[model samples]
Every structure is written in C-alpha cells, then in structure tokens.
Target chain A: MRVLGVDPGLTRCGVGVVEGVAGRPLRMVGVGVVRTPADADVADRLVLIERGIEQWLDEHRPEYVAVERVFSQHNVRTVMGTAQASAVAMLCAARRGLPVALHTPSEVKAAVTGSGRADKAQVGAMVTRLLRLDAPPRPADAADALALAICHIWRAPATNRLQELAAAHRRTPTPVRIPKGTR
Target chain B: MRVLGVDPGLTRCGVGVVEGVAGRPLRMVGVGVVRTPADADVADRLVLIERGIEQWLDEHRPEYVAVERVFSQHNVRTVMGTAQASAVAMLCAARRGLPVALHTPSEVKAAVTGSGRADKAQVGAMVTRLLRLDAPPRPADAADALALAICHIWRAPATNRLQELAAAHRRTPTPVRIPKGTR
Candidate 1:
C-alpha cells in the first residue's frame, strides 16, 4: 500500500511518500518540505501549511497517511505548534477518508534501525540505504518523514491485527457465569 | 465589529458571537457548545469540531474570530487537545479571510470582570450583565466564550495599534549612524 508520511512542524513540515507492502521492495514516491517563514503570523503560517499538505495529498493520493505523534515536550510553545500542525495533517487525511496512523519517534526509529535510541544520523543513513537514494535527504525532517512511511509500512500490519482483535472482543464481550448454588 | 469567540476543548467546545464597537453596548448573537463523546477517536472528534466551527463561521459571518490562547497546562494531553481545537478555530477563520485574535484567559477575565483573577462565576455574572441576557448562560464554557467575545471587542483596538506601530517601524527601519572616526 502507498503511504504518505508527514513530519509536522510549524516552520518546516516534512512530506514523504513510500509505496510497498511487508516483505516487498519499497520505493520513494516523493519527498519535500513545506516551509513558512519564522516571522509570519501563526494563522497565516498554518494556512500555508494547509495548502501545502492539500497539494501533496492531491498529488500523491496515498492510501494511508502516517504522522509523527507528538509527545509532551519540554518546550510548551514548540510542542503546541507541532501538535497543531500534526492535527492539520490528520484533518487533511480525514477529509479524504484515508486512514491515518500516528507513530512515535522512538517507534519509527526502532522499526527502521532495530533500535529505539537510533540517532538522527543513523536514521538518515538507514533511510538513504533503504530507499536506495544517492544521498540522505537534507534537514533530517525530510528523511524522518521517509522513515515514518517505511516504519508504518512495515509495522502497521501488527497494529491492525491487534485492533481487529480488540474490536472482536468488544463485539462479543466477556462472558460471565454465576457459581452453582443451592436454591 | 462582530466577533466570534471560541473556547476550544476536546469534549466540549464553547462558541459565542458578539457584535459591537468600542464604547457601545455589546449584543450576544449566539452562544452554545459543540460536544463530542469522550471515548471517540481523536481524529473523529477533531473532524466533528472542524465541522462545528465551520458551521459557526458560515452562520455568524463575524468580522473577527477570537480564540482563547492555551497556556502550558500540567496535563499535556488536555493542553494538546485544546491547542489542536484552538488551531482549528483559527484555520476556519483564516479560510474565511476573517482576522483572528487569541486572548489569554486572564486577559478575558480582566476585561470582563475588572480582575485578572476573577472566578468563573464572576465572569459569568459580568457577561450576563454586559450582554443584558435574561440569565447567565448554562455551562461555564458558554459563558467564558461570551466573555472572550467581549474581551476581544474591548481589547483588540489597543492590540491593533501596537501591531500597526511595529509594522510601521519595520517599513522604515531605524537609522544607523557611524562615528566620523570609526568609518
């Protein structure tokens, strides 16, 4: 399945698309960054980002969208902006009825390098090697987007299986029986 | 000017519209809450919220949209959700070409109740009095939204002046002089 991976940020949001299924060769469909000037108004920056992502969505038409899940960040301002951008990505995917998956940084790192503590250099190197590119994408964010897409393609089956199991459990809930007792 | 104020949250978002200029009586054009189930998926909830805010913008056609600026909260999850919702409000306003303003909670309280530390009850009472409503609106969120509207109407002029001054300064930047000996 084709997947669009979004590394959402206020000043520079990374967009990458990868197409493949598990145990199959993966191909990089596209890679780019949507940038807004640091001095621009927040609302205006978001509008630009919305337009950029919309354009990417229209061009790529990926079956699934993967976004980096934002954790509680020490810098509140930074985290808030990142979270807002992440939600914008989700909204774009939802508008098109495409299922969206959120992968944490550590999760993506582990899936790509087989280690959760992989550094940016290592992650970038792996992305370059895996995607068979001549050079690692610049500014880390772009490579990170590709990594997120590759991670989702490789790991999503497991997550989907778990979700299916949970849904089945919900459909036919837990059974309870009373102990036999004298009338 | 007419203002649509939004107090954004995940479970229940407050929205209110008020119209008036400085030194004039403010009228509450609308006040209500948009709700989503607490258990709903985050993406789904956000979609619902986007639709709700879009509808409000379409119906009210306010000149300005004001959102409560989210501060750093102890609960990261809660704050992130609020930030996401607030961004949605801003995005809707930006899409419609309506200018957006973000007011801090303390700022709204100070504008409405003459005290930055004013409690919700006091803010609600003042909002009721200011809008000449028959009674204080139900659910503190709705009242807070109206308070935000009033605050934006009352406070925006000064803020606009400051921004204008900054922009004007930028247009014709400060002159630099070098000492005769230094050159």
Candidate 2:
C-alpha cells in the first residue's frame, strides 16, 4: 500500500510518500516540504498550502494519507497554527476521497525508532537506514513526515484486522435471554 | 458594501450577510447556521464548512468576508475545532478573491455594543436593533455573525484611512541627516 504522510505546519508542511506494506521493504516515492512565507497573511498562507498539497496529491496519488495529529498541549504559540495546517491537509486528502489517518508524534517515533521518546536525530537516522537513502531527508520535519508514513504502513494491517472483527461483531445478532418472570 | 460574516464552528457554523456602510441603516441580507453531525470526522466537518461558506458567498456575492478570529485562549476542548473551521472559511473566501477580515470577539462586541466585554445577549439585542428586525437572530451564533459583518463595515473606513497613511509614509523618502564628523 502506498501512503502519503504530512507533518503539517503553516511555515513548512512536510510531505512524503512511501510505498510498501507491513513486514516488507518500503520505497520512497517522493518527499518534500511545502513552504509558505512568514510575512504572508494567514488566509493567503492557507491558500498557498492548499495549492501545494493539491499538487502533491495530483502527482503522487497515494491510496492513504497519514497526518501527524496535533495536540493542544504542545507549545501554546504554535499549536493553533499546527492544528489549522493539519486541518487543511486532512481536508485536501478527504476531498479527494482518500482515507486519512492521524498518528501522534510519539506513535511515529516509536514506530521508527522502537522508542516513543526518541529524539529527532534518532528518527532521522532510523528513516535513513530504513529507506536505504544516502542521508536522512533534510529538515527534521521531512524526516518526521517519512516516519509518519512508515508508521501508518506498519500499523494499518493490525488496525484493519481489528476493524474487521468489530464489523463482524456488529453483524452478529445478540442472543436473547429470558427473564425468570417473563414466562 | 456587502459583507458576509462567518462565526465558524465544526458543529454549527453561523453565517450572515449585511449590506450598508458606517453611520447608515444596515440591511440583513441573510442569516443562518450550517450544521454538521457531531459524530462526523474532523476532515468531513471542514469540507462541510467550506461548502457552506462557499454557498453563502455565491448567494450574496459579498464584496468582503468577515470571520471571527479564533484564539488559543478559548475553551481547550473546542478551540481547535473552532480554529479549523475558521481556516476553512478564510480559505474559501481567499480562493474567491474576496478580501477576508478577521474580527476578534471583543472587537465585535465593542463595535456592536459600547463595551468590549458585553455578553452575547447584549450583542444579539444590538444586532436586532441595528438591523431593525422584529427579533434577534436565533442560535446566538447567527447574531454574532451579523455583528461581525456590522463591525467590519463600521471599522473599514478608519482602517482604510490608516492603511492609506501607512502607504503614503512608505512612499515618502527618508530625510538624510549627516552625523557629526561624517560628511
């Protein structure tokens, strides 16, 4: 399965595409950052981001899109921007009818480095080794984006299995139990 | 001038259109709320908001769009949703080449009533009185949206004048003064 990962930010939204499934070697289809000028108005910046993301979507056409889920507990000043940017990314993916998944920072880190508390350098190193690239993707954001994609690819199988089980359970009728006084 | 005001929220996005200038009788062109299911996913909610805002813009053909500026200081649980919805509203307006203006809640209240700290009821009452409507707009959010449009219409004149002065200042050359011992 091919997946596009987005590490959303107003100033620099990182995007990367990874192709593979669980327990298999992955290939880096494409990776880059969508940069918006800091001096631009917020609305204009969002427009730029939308265009950039749309271009990426048109070029890569991944089956699933994974985005870093933002939490308000992060840096107070930047949390709002992150949330807004993530929303834009998700909206773009959803508009195209692509399934979108949100993974937390720790989840991405844990998937890549085998530790939830791994540092940026560790994530970068792991991505480089896993993708067999000469070097890690430039900018920590880019590495994080790749990590998100890898995480989604590795976790999807388990998630799908659990969903299937839930569906089966829902389809099964609940057995009726008669109360003692109900005749 | 015609302005479409948006009080954005994931579950209930309030939209209203007002036509008039400062110190004149304002007309309420339209007022309503675009609601999404509470259980809907975030990305879907944003799409709904974008569609709703676009419909309002197409119907009213407003010269300007006013959206409530979301701040991080709001209720923690809902602020993110509010921010995301506002982004979609702003994005839709910007994409259509309509000038988008963000008005803070305090600014809207101050423009409608005389106090920045005025409660929702006061602002709603003022919006009703100003629009000469028999009753205030329902759902408080709709009234708040109308108040936003009114605020923008009232403040645009002063803001334009200030912008003009700033532009003039930029156009003016700075006078050179020689320092002591420097020819």
Candidate 3:
C-alpha cells in the first residue's frame, strides 16, 4: 500500500510518501519539508503548514497515512507545536478517508534498523538502503518521515491479522451455561 | 466588530460568538461546544473538531477570531491536545482572512474580572453580568470562551494601534547615506 509518513513539527514538518507492502521493494514517491518563520504570527504559520500538508496530500494521494506518534507526556516543551502539526497532518488524511496509523519513535527505529536504540543517522541510512536511493533524503526530519512510512508498510500485515483475530473474537458471543436450577 | 472566541480542547472545544465594539452593548450571537469521545481515533477526533469549528464559523460569519493563547508548557498531559485544538481554530480564522487575536488566561480573567487570579466562577459571573445574560453560560469552557471574546473586544484598540505603528514604520523608507565623495 502507498503510505504517507509525517514527522510533524511546527517550524519544520517533514512529509515522505512511499509505495510498497511487506516483502516488497519500497519506492520513494515524494519527499519534502514545510518550514515556517519564527517571526510570523502563529496563526499564519499554522496556515502555511496546513496548506503545505494539504498540497502534499492532494498530490500523493496515499492509501494510508503513518504518523510519528507523540507518546510522552513528560516533556512540556515542544509538545504543543509538535502535537498541533501532527493533528494537522492527521486531519488531512481524515479528510480523504484514509486509514491512519501511528508509530512510536522506537517502533520506527526498530522496524527500519533492527534496533530500537539506533541513532538518527542509522535510521536514515537504513531508509536510504531500503528504498534503494543513492543518497539519504535531505534533512533528518524528511528521512525520519520516510522511515515511519516504511515501518508502517512492514508492520501492517501483522497488525491486520491481530485486528482480524480481535474482530472474530468479538463477533462470536461467549456460550452461556445453565446452572443446576437455572433454565 | 463580530468576534468568535475559541476555548480549544480536544474532547470539548468551546466556541462563542459575540457582536459589538468597545464601550458598546456586547450581544451573544452564538455559543456551543464541540465534543468527541475520548476513545475515538485521533484522526477522527480532529476531523470532528475541524468540521465543528468550520460549521460555527460559517454560521456566525464573524469578522474576527480570538483564541486563547497557550502559554504554559508545564502540563504535558493535555497540552498537546489543547494546542492542536487551538491550531485548528486559528486555521479556520486564517482561511477566511480574519484577524486573529490571542489572549492569555490571566489576561482574559483580568479583562472580565477586576483581578487576574479570579476563579472560573468569577469569570463566568462577570461574563453573565457584562453580557446581561439571565444566567451564566453552561459549561465552564463555554463561559471562558465568552470571556475571551469580551477580552479581545476590550483589548483590540491597543493592539490595533501597535499594529498600525508597526505598519507605518515598515512603509517609510530608511535613511541611506552616500560615501564622502559620492554625495
């Protein structure tokens, strides 16, 4: 499946689109970053990011959107802007009725580099090799976004099976048993 | 001026539309909250919020939007969600070319009540009295939104003057000096 991965940030939002599924060679469809000035009004900056993401979505039309999830509630700084950008990305996907998946930083790292503790450079190098590109994508954020998409594509099959199993369990009601004197 | 105040929240975003100018009778054009389930998918929740805010804007046709500025990054738990909702509100305003204003919690409280540290109930009571409402608006968030609108109306004149001064300075050319013999 074609997937658009978002490494969301207020100042710089990275977007990468990849096409492939499990056990297939992934191809890079698109990659870019949206940058906004710190001096601009917050509303104006947000508008810029929103429009940029919308343009990317319209152009790529990914079947699924994989976003880097913000799982930490520990750090107060940078959370707000990051979350805002993440939400904007998600909104774009939702508007198009695309299935959205979220992967943690560690999950993406492990999926791409086979090590949860792999550094950014390692992940970037893995993304480059996996996509068969001569060079890694420009800007670390862009490379990270590509990694997120690759992670989602590789993990989707297992996730689908788990979801299917859960659905089956839900559909079959538990058998009721009669007590000694109960009808 | 007509102003829409947004109390941004992920689960319950409060929106209030008020019409009037400073030193005039402020009337409530509309008031409501957009709510989504806590268990809903993040993308779906954002889409719900985006649509709700858009509906409010379309229905009210407000000339300006006043959003509560997120100041503290102290609380990591809900800050992300709040900031995301705030961004959504700002995007709606920006899309319509409306001038957006941001007010801090303390500023809103100070504008509504005589003190910056006034409690929510105090702010609500003042909002009711200022708007000549029969009772305080339902939900604290809704009341806070009205207070935000009121704050913007009262503070806008000063903000406008600053903006004007800044714009005027930008328009005038800066002095350029010629070298000693070139003059």
Candidate 4:
C-alpha cells in the first residue's frame, strides 16, 4: 500500500510518501515540507497549505493518507495551528476519496522505533535504517512524516482485522428469549 | 460591506450573512447551519464542511468572511474540532480570495450586547434587535454567527486603521544613528 504521511503544522507541514505492506521492505518515494509564512493571515496560510498538499497528491497519488492525530494537550501555544493544518491535510485526502488514518505521535514512534517514548534522533535512525536511506530525512518533521506512513502500512492489517471482527459482532443480532409465563 | 460569518463546529456549523457598514443598519441576508453526522469520519466531516461553506460563498458572495477565532484554552474536549472546523471555513473563503476576519467570542458578544460577558441569550436578543428581525435566529449557533458578522462590520473601520498604521510604520525605515566618535 502506498501511503502519504503528513506531520501537520502551520509553519511547516512535513509530508512523505512510502510504499509497502506489512512484513515487506518499505520504499520512500518523496519527502518534503510545505511551509507557510508566519506573517501571513491564518486563512491565507491554509490556502497555501491546500495548494501544497494538492501538488503532493497530484504527484504521488497515494492510496491512503496518514496524518498525525493532534492533541490539544501537546503544546498549548501551537495546538490550534497543528489542528488546523491537520484539518487541511485530511480535507485534501478525503476530497479525493482516499482513506485517511490518524496515528498518534507515540503510535508512530512505537511503530518505527519499538518505543513510544523514543526521541527524534531514535525515530530518524529507525526510519533511515528501515527505508534503506543513505541518511535520515531532514527537519525532524520530515522523518516523523515517514514514520507515520510506515506505521500506517504496518498496522493496517491488524486494524482491518479488528474492524472486521467488530462489524461481525454487530451483524450478529442478540437473540431474545421468550419467558414461559409471557408466552 | 457584506460579511459572511461562520460559527465553526463539527456537528453543526452555523453561518449567517449580513450586509451593511459600521454606522448604518445591517440586513440579514441568510442564516442556517451545516450539519454532519456525529458518526462521520473527521476527514469526511471536513469535506462536508468545505462543501457547505462553498455553497454559502457561492450563494452570498460576501465581501468578507468572518469566522470566530478558536482559542485552545476553550473547552479542551471540543477545542480541536472547533479549530479544525474553523480552518475549513477559512480555507473556503481564502480559496475565493475573499478577505477573512476572525472575531473573538468576547468581541462578538460585546459588539452586539455592549458587554463582553453577555450570555448567549443576550447576544441573540441584541442581534435580533440590531437586525430588526421578528425573533432571534433559531439555534444559539446561528445567532452567534450573526453576531460575528455584526462584530466584523462594526470593528472593520478600527481594524483597517490599525492595519494601515502598522503598514505605514513598516514602510518608514528606521534611521541609522552615528555617534560623534564613530563619525
């Protein structure tokens, strides 16, 4: 599965495309950051982000898009910006009917480094090694984007199974027992 | 000046359009809510918001789009959704190259009711009074949206002056000072 991972931010949105399924070698197709001027209005900045993400979608045409799930508790100052940027990214993917998945920061870190608390350097190291890259992607955000893509590719199988099981359970209706007295 | 105001929310996004300048009477062109199913995916919800906002823009073609500024300090649980919804609203306006203004909740309340701490009912009542409506718009969100538009219209003059002053200051470069010894 080819997935485009987005590490959403207002100032600098990191994007990376990775292709592979679980239990297979992953290949990095592209990596870059979509930057917006800090001095620009938030609305104008969102328009720029939309254009940037659209360019990436046009070029990569990934089957799925993975975005970092934003939590309001992360950074009090920039949480709003992060959430806004993520919204633009998700909107772009969903507009094209592409499935979008959100991975928590820790989930991406754990998927790549085997530790949810792994630092940036650790994630960078793992992404480089896993993708057989000559060096880790620049600007920690870029590496994190790749990590998100890797996480989605690796976890999709299990997620699908769980979803299937839940669906099956819902499909099976509960049987109602008739009381002898009521009957 | 005509303004389209948006009260962004995931489940129900309220929108209203008001046409008038700061001093004169304002006219309510339209008022409604764009709703998405609670069970819908966030990405799909955003797309629905985008479409809804686009339709409003297409129908009204307001000179300015006014959106409530989302603060992270607000309801922690729903703040993220609010931010995301606001982003989509801004994106729709900015894509059309329309000027977008964000009014704080207090600002909107104060503009209509003369008190920043006014309750929803107060704001709604004032909005109905200001617009000469038969009754307050249905749904608190819808009334709040009209209040936002009213705020933008009332505040635009001062905001423009401030922005003009700031721009003029930027244009006027600071003179370099040379000490006698240096000279």
True contacts kept of each: 0.57, 0.67, 0.78, 0.98
Tens digit per residue, CA lDDT, model 1, A1-183: 999999999999999999999898899999999998999778877888899999999999999899999987658889989988888888888878888889999999999999999999999999999999999998889999999999999998997788678768778956777678933
Docking quality tier of candidate 3?
Answer: medium
Task: Tell me, by lDDT, which candidate is best.
Answer: 4
Residue by residue across B1-183, what tens digits does model 4's lDDT show? 899999999999999999999889889999999999987789999999999999999999999999999987768869999999999999999999888889999989888888999999899899999999999998999999999999999999998788689779879989989888985
Residue-level lDDT of model 2, residues A88-109, one tens digit each, is 9999998887878899999999
The TM-scores, one per candidate, come to: 0.91, 0.90, 0.89, 0.91
lDDT of each: 0.90, 0.91, 0.89, 0.94
Question: Which is the better candidate, 2 or 3, if ranked by lDDT?
Answer: 2
- Can you give the DockQ of every candidate in the order shown? 0.59, 0.62, 0.57, 0.77
lDDT of 3 at B9: 92
- Looking at candidate 2 chain B, the ten consecutive residues that score lowest on lDDT are B158-167
lDDT tens digits by residue: candidate 2, B85-160: 9889889989988788899999999999989999999999999999999999999999999999999999999866
- lDDT for B37 in candidate 4 is 94
Candidate 1: clashing pairs of residues: none
Q: Model 4 off-target regions past 4 Å?
A: A162-183, B165-183
- Please state the CAPRI-style docking class of candidate 2: medium
| Model 1 residue B163 CA deviation in Å | 3.3
Model 2 accuracy (lDDT, Cα): 0.91
How should the candidates be ordered by DockQ, best one leading?
Answer: 4, 2, 1, 3
